[model samples]
Target: MSNRFKNLIVPVLAVVLGMLVGTIIMLVTGYDAGAAFSALFEGAFGDIYYTGETIRQVTPYILAGLAVGFAFKTGLFNIGVEGQLIVGWLASVWVGVAFDLPKIIHLPLAVLAAAAAGALWAFIPGFLKARFRVHEVIVTIMLNYVALHLSNYLIRTVLSEKSDRTPNIHDTASLKSPFLEGLTDYSRLHWGIVIALICVFIMWFILQKTTLGYELKAVGFNQHASEYAGMNVRKNIILSMVISGAFAGLAGAMEGLGTFGYAPVRGGFTGVGFDGIAVALLGGSAPIGIVLAALLFGSLKVGALNMPLEAGVPNELVDIIIALIVFFVGASYMIRIFIERLSKKKGVK
Candidate 1:
């Protein structure tokens, strides 16, 4: 099979295997697997409301997945998406609530702040990696903790309102759901989905059509070789991280400006950033693949909330299924072998 065909086949098979495993687990737990699955489907796609919620949930995942996937394409492991996301959230919210401008100006300004903050947060690790040979994975991991604490402190002490959250943002800064009135009750789905799609297209264009993308990929494949070939390995490395961070920041801002309307005190880590790793893996780190993967995860998350209420299944079951999918995708060689063996058994010669 062609490489493209294999890439598509692997993720599809992984998902099928994950569902089969999930079904077995459900049966073992004494639940009606069919009923549970039915409920899950209904909750995820049964009605317009559910579908909108799934899209809303997936919007951030798309951005976060892009952040990780983009870095992976350039051969970098960016564990610091969590930190970059937090900083982006804080910066956007800070601008959104602090300013009193018109909606057009305020919203754009907040978005810009988010991107800049994320880029700055990512820059530190990139600099260390390019200049001092410090491993980006380690630096990014450490920065995640720093960002969490710093963001918590800022919300509680520096920007806190009477409540634990900042004030509701200016009207102009809010991303109202245009389809909400026409659809199910009050879905949070907004224009961010469009923004995410645009980003996906941009990522594809950059990676497949640009010189900078070629340089970054070269550096990722082999920095020494790229350098020998006259590519600026260090520059590409640093630029990749910055671009990755910018995407992460947009993910965080999507939550703040698009959904919440204000920055709440993040009591602990939000799983969005970490979840991006799974998304990137499941999507095979391809732009189109990442979008689909994010949508699937988003549907699962929204549907899981309804499982207990409608199917008497634990919400944690969804997490288990997700973990299984990620595991299968990561160890796809086994699946590939199985496919080869099956193909041989069905020989038509």
Candidate 2:
């Protein structure tokens, strides 16, 4: 097989293996795997409404995945994406609620606030890692809790109207479009998908075509060599985290301005940030790969809801399938070796 073909082989086989394992589990558990999959497909793409929801879910997933993927490319692990997202959501809503500007101005302002908030939230860990050599993974993880509690407290003490969540943002700051929602049969689809796509192209352009990106990547590949070449390694490290957090924050902005129009979480974590890690990993930390992986995971999420409702399969089974896929992705080296061995055997014969 050609190199291009080999690159795709493991992922394709992994997907097939995941499905086969799911089927076996379903059979063992006394459920019809085909029926469950049918229900899943129906839920994800059987109709325009389902398709819209899947796209809507994919929107944030893409941004979140990009956030994590960007950091990975820079040799940083931004596990604090969850914290950054939470802070961004709160900041966006705060701006939206406090402002009464025209639509164009108000909307962009709210989004910028989200991005700024996310960047600032990530800056601490990034700075620590760069200046003091602190482990970013630990700091980012701890900051997640800080963001959750801070947002919750702020809502309770200041923004809440005798409720758990703040009031919905002004219509001018909203990303929701009446026409788009109607077009999707009243699903919560909005223009955020457009923004997500824009981010993908922008990230691709930056990484592949920009001088700054080249420096950042060089630093990631070898900080000592990059430093010898006169690159600002510390600056690049901090900048990478800031940009990564910005993308995650934009994801939270999507939920605030388009999906919910308010800041609300049932628990400490929204799980979207954590899901981004898996999405980034499965995508191999590539820009286009992140987008495709996000869509796949988004479909599974939307479809999982129907498995229990229509097919008598627990939704947790979908989680297992997802975990299995992640495992396969992580174990790709073994698959590559096996494929190479087979190729050599064929040549020898």
Candidate whose TM-score is highest: 2
Candidate 2 collision pairs: none
Model 2 TM-score on a 0 to 1 scale: 0.97
Clashes of each: 1, 0
Q: Over the stretch 1-349, how does candidate 1's per-residue lDDT look in tens digits?
A: 4567778999998998999999999999899888888888889988888888888899999999999999999999999988898899889888988889988798889988988899999999999999999999999999999999888878888887546777777777766656663565667778778878888998999999999988889899999999999998888989999999999999988988888877777777889999999999999999989999999999999988888888899989999999999989988999888877777787854
- Give the Å error, residue 177, model 1: 3.3
lDDT of candidates 1 onward, in order: 0.89, 0.91
lDDT of 1: 0.89
Candidate topping lDDT:
2
lDDT of 2: 0.91
Point out where model 2 deviates above 4 Å: 1-4
Q: Once model 1 is optimally superposed onto the true structure by TM-score, how far is the C-alpha of residue 108 displaced, in angstroms?
A: 1.3
Residue-pair clashes, model 1: 1
TM-score, model 1 to reference: 0.96
